[model samples]
Target: MPADQLTDLLDPARWDPLPHPPAMEYPLPVRRRDPRTLPPAPATGSAPEVLSRGADGVLLRLRHRAPRARAVALHASGWWRPQPADALDLVPAGDGWWEIVLEAPADWRTSYGFVEHDGPGDPPWWEAGLKAPGAPVHPDALCAHRHGAARGGAERSVLSLPFDGLFRAGRDDAETPAEVHELPLGPDAPRVRWWVPEEAGPAPLPLLVVTDGAEHVEQLGTPERLRRGVEAGVLPPLVAVFVDAGEHRGDVLGVPGGQARWIPEDLVPRLRAAGLTAPGGRRLALTDDPARTIITGASYGGLTALFTAARAPGTIGIAIAQSVSLWRYPRGALVGPLREAAGYAPLRLRLHAGRFEGSMAADARALADALDGSGAEVTLDLHSGGHDWAWWQPALLHDLAAELGR
Candidate 1:
């Protein structure tokens, strides 16, 4: 696509309502439930149902039943401050069913919801409370699977395809789970959740520091995934620290701030004081070497991961930034400084982004290109899907294994 065309694609204003594609384009399999029998046979069946699978991709049918609704729209993650015009409006099926068929990759997963407009005129765009005069977004009542709760305490519906991966599934019955502990740094600082291997040998282990700790723990099940990787020999036994930012996430992780420095300056020193850095102190020990220390996060946290590593390469050597918000800064603003810093200490970076994330995806590619051969070992992995945790959780596991398994 041309640059102009790509810009238009990214612009939500250009996204008009769409109708379901022709049957020939997305041929429904005979074994699958037909669109006419929708709301599923049992009536309580979960959605968005998989209509068909083909060489191209899978066809997903997302539906909502609102008998008196004037309009309905679909809202997915990564769309910030979404307006009704920015969303995909669903067409009326029959009775009161409104639905849209989407084509997605086999491994795609995302959190989505439906907006029902009942009032006169245009529906209001979503606000913090979703209390705008016109419409409010609601999770798919028919879909049992749900993602994390948003600002208004409303959970979004999850649409996930079959994925054959170590991290997506829960731990096996026989595998020993990683021991989780809480570390309080001070009243002013956020608490940290630590995960130590159950059978950590008496040797210094690699460390992974994750930002946006609470969400990764509660929503993504990251610690368990890490535990699974270690037991399966896909990753080395290690210590992982999840740093909770709480309400101060934007102040700390969004930019270069004092609280952001706590990870390298205060947190590491405190962990050492607890005898986590050397062997023979307890069940598990962590490496003091920055080369074995990896820091990772997504979105704004992702931007912070790169910033933290660049600022303190001696404390953090590897950075795995997933779906980074490089656009938060001016275009290429971070590239020059990052390149200069890497030229001095040389950092290893793994940049991951989704091809569906518009300019964010382009920015990741641009950052990778700008950092090339600048004394930094940089690798960029572009995956299918959007900025939802559905992709970030599994991608983080793969990154950890790739970086630490060797």
Candidate 2:
């Protein structure tokens, strides 16, 4: 009756076909006696090697042990004012540190660190390691520093159209929403699996589309989180589209042209023909202008969110990238799209990574630096844990109220 071909929606291996660093489920503070920040990479500990640089920006190698704190603010102290750029981001190793790039004037001084209301759960941001005897926390802020690292590159809009052939759906049929559905790209095509939420009733509802599919659901427990966002008004009552990854995730995500086809040739048309996508419609171009639509994932999935926005600027609005592994593809795949990307119809991005996600920080910072350089409306947060979910959950809820609603 309702696509019997779709079943076994929670298969992790089947969903997250690409390899993305794993992340924690929440962010809890680690009570350390001596609070000190790790000085500089090339100076104190091992910093990643610099790969290449151009007028666009410098591309530094990533150090798996780098330390990047969570929920930092670029305040008056000069945290991000001493570099060739004006922002920073991280790739978490979930180990002892995270990879990040500092952007500000070569000569600058400022204070910053993790920020959170001193209350119930855990402070939103905490400086894990700092050692400038009397280094002084913002007291009102975090930590201060003189001089920022040189960073950033050319800015551009990317149309994320990775299509080795890949990748949502409906509300009205949701009265008792089908938990799983097998959607064929065409009338006589190979059927791919689509996991629908158990939410009932069709009515108009927002949507959350996940690329890594099952792994996102299991590791991040997104279904539960989305359910909560809905109930709490952090997000509109929404329908979720969990697409199980087929062999081509990287192939599709690593390239751009293919992406457009996947959605146009395969994903989008199918949803429209099925009559499931009414609110967000069949593609990014058709999504709501003011309505909140979020697309996210870890590693490749995270990368795809950036790609998706580049591909269909006005289609979707909010994007969350967790431990996005940009290096998994080529710099151009990300850069080229971002450079040419347009239609910045008020899109928002939330990026997160464990303090130690390894070489992947290159991937993390590239996007963050790009977003900040372009002056795109974006927010970046980091946590103590490495690429694990224990940390991802906190970033999700912290911004829930802001992104979803009241």
Q: After superposition, how far is residue 236 of candidate 1 from its true place, in Å?
A: 3.0
After aligning candidate 2 to the native by TM-score, how far in Å is the CA of 119 from where it should be?
Answer: 47
Look at candidate 1 and tell me the lDDT of residue 394: 74
lDDT for 336 in candidate 1 is 58
5-100 in candidate 2: lDDT tens per residue?
Answer: 111121122333335435322222221111124334452432223333344334432333323343222222112121212123243435544444
State which candidate has the highest TM-score: 1
Q: What are the lDDT scores of the predictions, listed in order?
A: 0.69, 0.41
Candidate 2: segments with Cα more than 4 A from true spot:
1-203, 217-221, 257-261, 264-274, 277-287, 329-333, 373-375, 393-401
In terms of lDDT, which candidate is strongest? 1
Candidate 1, lDDT over the whole model:
0.69
Candidate 1 per-residue C-alpha lDDT over 38-70 given as tens digits, one digit per residue, 9 for 90 to 100: 444334567777877887588777889999998
